[model samples]
Target chain A: MTTATTTDLYPTRGTAEVLTPRQDPVVWGAPGTTGPLRPSELGDFDRDGFLPVDALIGPEDVARYHAELERLCADPAVRADERSIVEAKSRDIRSVFEVHKISPVFAELVRDPRVVDRARQILGSDVYVHQSRINVKPGFGASGFYWHSDFETWHAEDGLPRMRAVSVSIALTENHDTNGGLMIMPGSHRTFLGCAGATPEDNYKKSLQMQDAGTPSHTALTELAGRHGIRLFTGQPGSAVWFDCNCMHGSGDNITPYPRSNVFIVFNSVENAAVEPFAAPVRRPEFIGARDFTPVR
Target chain B: MTTATTTDLYPTRGTAEVLTPRQDPVVWGAPGTTGPLRPSELGDFDRDGFLPVDALIGPEDVARYHAELERLCADPAVRADERSIVEAKSRDIRSVFEVHKISPVFAELVRDPRVVDRARQILGSDVYVHQSRINVKPGFGASGFYWHSDFETWHAEDGLPRMRAVSVSIALTENHDTNGGLMIMPGSHRTFLGCAGATPEDNYKKSLQMQDAGTPSHTALTELAGRHGIRLFTGQPGSAVWFDCNCMHGSGDNITPYPRSNVFIVFNSVENAAVEPFAAPVRRPEFIGARDFTPVR
Candidate 1:
């Protein structure tokens, strides 16, 4: 293992308050890396598997991040990597994955206190964003998603150890039905549901030796919705949603003339961080996730 | 056109109460075929894409329907249809599609007053179960679905005219996270969202004529969920969630040892009933949907 020196102590994406640099590097569960949660919020989170921090982020930060998203997406150099830039049915820019590795603004967004404090409270330890992305459903014809769970992807694709992580979705626009908003089943974190999808043992191989996971069938969606009942989350520009990784969730298409955008950061407990996919000995790519296990204050 | 005969007036599905034989054949939109909704409920339905009728169904009805779901799924005849029986990675039963056409109990579920009454109020006319199914995420290995908008399928494949329809998810048992509960983005009914999925115009010809609509990418889901947030529906047996046809939704897999079962019914306004898919002269198969336009009260 490499020694933690002052020069290379904090592998921070940027100067976001969520990842404050410590005088000394520490592993998870170390002191000064976390804060206490409000009793009521913790209770609700434990019971509901989700919580909302309404308007916790300031307007300036939201504007800055939104601008940065647009700037990065427009840069041709950023779009060179197929994995970083994804397209919708209309061929519009849909999402920018792994932005924390390329842009300081996005890196800072990952470490925001509004997200980290709650995540730590949920995981009860230090955390890192295993996956970070910005979903941009711009104007009309931005495609919607089918129903599936994130753990299904994390466990099947990344070999994540457990369902101990949380996902934070930070809204950059008015999230409404017309703009491809999110829908979730509450209290869904209590259990891990099985799934239907491709399971390639060597997906991350240089040759991409695995097939992609197929979407859940229509019959499966119809049945789950019947028993659980579904709900939507429409918040103003600066609100944030904290959800359990095991919760079953999905979103609609943005066929409206308006645009919908947000930054999504998936935080896994350092204790529960995944190794390489399919039991591989080497670590996964840094763009997907890093092997650095230092706790972020 | 052939005159409506008393013997075959309804083109009924079994002997369900909703399709009770009538001495005289009445056209769709006739009075007495639909009931009124409370003004408050109507307002809520207009504002929010969905509304829940809590305990509207009695315990006896719930039990009866649940039992029928189990009985029908196990029968070889019902499972014979490849489209009806779906499997997950774990190879357990995931869903039972087109239930209304196969079982009397499910046929009655199509016209459950709790569902039809409000549906007519929202639709402002008679309605029909264009599609009905039972999503069976049974205990271990029950698969979940990906996020998607249902109208994307209907409009592109079934020649549906508009979004003048609703889906009722009737809980046959307790719907929780472990069992792959239904989740939604609230108020997603305000506008029609574009989607990525199989476009079947060419599918019917065996030439692979049309490209399948792409699945919602990871970025798209993250953006929408951030803006709108998401919520789950967990209710006791017999409670139902009535949702807009265009809502973005999906569910989780059930790894737990508990089964999550529910019947799903999609009601389309008689005036808004679909024509042949993609403007084709021939109709889609019955197992997919019905061409019988006889209205149900």
Candidate 2:
């Protein structure tokens, strides 16, 4: 029997108190939970550091979210003020959670059994919600955001959770390769740093390449995304794509007239963890809807 | 005349939208916003691919957030349930924006003018709130989280916004060397896909003889943080640290009795370009409270 030892390769906190509550029944003792992550998934995660779990959300939900988003955008209540306004033409759509509670579809997407189970198998206890939000992109020429990473922000020396924290994006519209669908760099997430927090000039200097210069015509991955199997996740409404938070991804332009919308949520284990809120606060209606929620540590 | 066509580099659609409304504002108009970024800040960002802005959360605000966190943790009504629980002993928290709305202190911290201005300087136009959350690590014996970049979980594209996003962490308490302050591989962010996101087992197989077993060490900037006057920000309450999301970073054990806490936020410009959310979402009450705020494209 593998006796629990402090010096074991996987040195755990030993006490049950140190363990995080299991959110997915599949990994824990809860019934109807799935089996352990497949070797293929593990191998992908190990080699690429992430994998995309498909069909997380469906089409019907996407339509609903888009409609609700349109309503929110039209509402005069969601105006940008001086203090809250961070951009020139950007109308601050403060907190969507206040104006709208997560649709049941959104909540279902978050509480997906397969995802929770997979997280449990990889992360092991102490899993917690890192953040969730809805980003609605309207038509207009905005300067493209620079590339960057999520982990670079919350730098910590102790109490960081093991395994990849999962970030799930639910498309509320039919995203196509041309109409601002999500694009990724395949294995680049495990290789390239993806310009987290650096300026374009700095990136140019460091990489010796200009931002618009485009990936070198010689690069294999660029060629692959361009010619061969460049996987573009153009999902129907409500179709969700779940990936590791560190994955390298960017959105295509809304070249089409329709607005591109999506809801995102990230989750991490809570055990032996030290996490703080990373953004400004938003309001949540107290409908006793989602009961027994834990507080941020 | 410097028409749009003449400008080689332009802002993203989201960024452009944000800037469109403020094109007349002196701060963002002409020379002020058009000039190149500061050398040192740019260097820091270039070398590490990111920089940390200070006082992301004021000292007093940190104190209040701590208090509210304590109340939420202690509240019996917020206990984890069967489905939601992840770790048995560790409890997960959610929806902090609700509490933040009531506390003017947190509002001020989130909208800290200085931090926002710096962010604008670094990442032009409107900054999108990628995520926000407070993490508390109770002394659990879980192995320290693996060493990896945040963007590794997403796609592998080299030019994705994962490269441009900046994360800011406001230390709520004094993080000492012993108590597990953040450890970073200085300048590691600039390496050409060096040994980052490597498996722990692979890293172990390649560990340096002089290094301690199982303790991960980065190669690029390891020696720089301590040598040549390179300072490690042993972050104190009210002080914030920012770095490239791709910068090599990890945490140590929280051997102390008290928990480690901090407020972290990731920002990106939303313009004509699009990128998926990398991490989980924590609530932003300030976004909900501030009406008439323009949504940063």
Candidate 3:
């Protein structure tokens, strides 16, 4: 155990906070060499650690995705699969993981030029899905996520070595201000906030439903939110947000009648494949953090 | 991988059946020196592989357990727990595992002499909880389990070296003949049926809710049922049945209005602790199959 900890790069669950400086560049490619985004849009992504695309998919595509989401939720086999996480309070499906493998519709969605090209532009390499899911926030009794960076979990538990991943959340429903929508901290991706609690054995089992470990402490969240003001993403159904893996993000519970849902896809550069977890006792299951690093065509 | 297979004592998932003879004794102790049972009762258990206790607990204790089961099923936190497996077709709680640790009422129940003494007598040593669960087969759409032996899974996935384990299922509800009641093959404990098909990665995740892999083939089940014959357990609430780990058993779906619930506990000999899985890629989580070998006093 001592030897294992000695070589740790991003040590978490300590008495005090250890903010590791970001070693990798936010956007790997610059200007004309990138996939589709203009130089000005690339500049905004590099500066703010996120870029909101007003029209990622057309209205027809959004409707198709919404129908697919409903079908997946209603399917008994999908609910029976361990990958589908149910809401804590209600019978509604909270999230269905490994969506690409579960549905051909989602499998095709991941390969789309609008989704895959932007990821290739940001990471500057052929990418594979590290994770993909449909996060559903049903109208009543939907739970919220706490303030935490995705990279913290991916690194500590999924064995993701670098922050060379981008998460694309394409809205399936209108993300009203009142509905529980993603809230990310602008410019907070540069520093990795080392968390302060040992990850429990088989942590993924509980953490999927309610993440307690590898979360930012109250002090760390307060400092980061103060340094970089929070940004709540509210848009029409087809809008999408591409954010850095290390950005501090969370969401509120949807108490309103309107539901909020998205097709969340994470593309990790093939160059940075997963290894053994840096802090956790074991790597999570393939459905949560994929080990099959086959590059997307 | 070749070296690992050569060393495997009980190989599974091949094209043909591999009926390994039982190397361990079903009832380890002789008559008078055993923990609680008489000579005739011990002989019956050795022959039939199962013995039923008419009244394992009083009516008041049964009421207490019923109340506790109701409480656990309704609690949101318990439902949120990954240990609580939901039904395939509905949001109903199917089974809540690690019951000894989950509820104080259950913790006390395991230590009761009527339960633990018989386990010690049959195992002929100090015993520990290899697994404990409250299986709730609620009427209307609750699923049934196909025929399978518990030891096949314990040996393949949990890495238990020997078949020196006993499972006690104490009925919390009156198990009517129409409702789903446990059916076991008499004298089936002598042969260890090495199941066909490779145990899928993270099999417990799916197997807990509905097992597919690591199960005996239809041919094997047919032969066993033909030879040994089947016996269905239907009794009033508080009745308990003690069976060897290797016995082939399964239950039907509770289509009747009455519900069938049981506090199922498995006790393994302290000497027969777990190691790396013999057939599976990895051992199951501690909640489903415990690794801790601390003797229960």
Q: Is candidate 1 or candidate 3 better by TM-score?
A: 1
Tens-digit per-residue lDDT, A137-194, candidate 3: 9863366776778999999898888889999999999886545578788999999889
- In model 1, what is the error at residue A16, expressed in angstroms? 40
RMSD of 1: 11.7
Q: In model 2, where do residues sit more than 4 Å from their true spots?
A: A1-297, B1-39, B50-57, B75-108, B139-143, B154-162, B192-232, B272-297
lDDT digits (tens) for residues A1-297 of candidate 1: 999432322121122211211221112233343454566666676666677878857799899989998898788887776545455345556677688877888887767776687778677677887888888877534555556566655654566756677888989987753455777766555544444433444444322211134234445445555555566677888888888776667665443445888988888888777754432334446665556666665
Please give, for residues B193-214, the per-residue lDDT of candidate 2 as tens digits. 3222322322221221112222
Write out the backbone clash pairs for model 3.
none
* Winning candidate number (DockQ): 1
lDDT of 3 by residue, B1-297 (tens): 355432566676666669998888898865577567887888899999999998999899999999999999999999999899999888799999998999999999999998999899988889999999998998643667767889989988999888889999999998865455787889999999998778888789888877788777656776786688677788899999999999988764553345789999999999888888878888899998898889888
Which lDDT tens digits does candidate 1 get at residues B1-297? 899432222221122212121222112233344455566665566566677778768899998988898887777776776546556355444566677777877787777676777677677788887888887777534545556666655654566666677788888888753356776766554434444333444443331111134234455556665666666677888888888776667664453345788888888889877764532334556556656666776
**Over the stretch A1-297, how does candidate 2's per-residue lDDT look in tens digits?**
798522211122122211122222112223333455676665665455355555554555556667766665556654331111122245434224322233454455455565455665555453545555566654321112222233322211122223245656677665543334554445433432211121232222222111221221223333333332224566666666656544444443331223456766656655423332121121111221112234222
User: Candidate 3 has what TM-score?
Assistant: 0.50
Model 2 CA lDDT for position A277: 16
Output the TM-score of candidate 1: 0.53
Candidates' DockQ values?
0.06, 0.01, 0.01
**DockQ: which is higher, 1 or 2?**
1
Ranking by TM-score: 1, 3, 2
Order the numbered candidates by lDDT, best leading: 3, 1, 2
Q: What's the true lDDT of residue B201 in model 2?
A: 27
Higher-scoring candidate on lDDT, 1 or 2: 1
What is the DockQ ranking, best to worst? Answer: 1, 2, 3
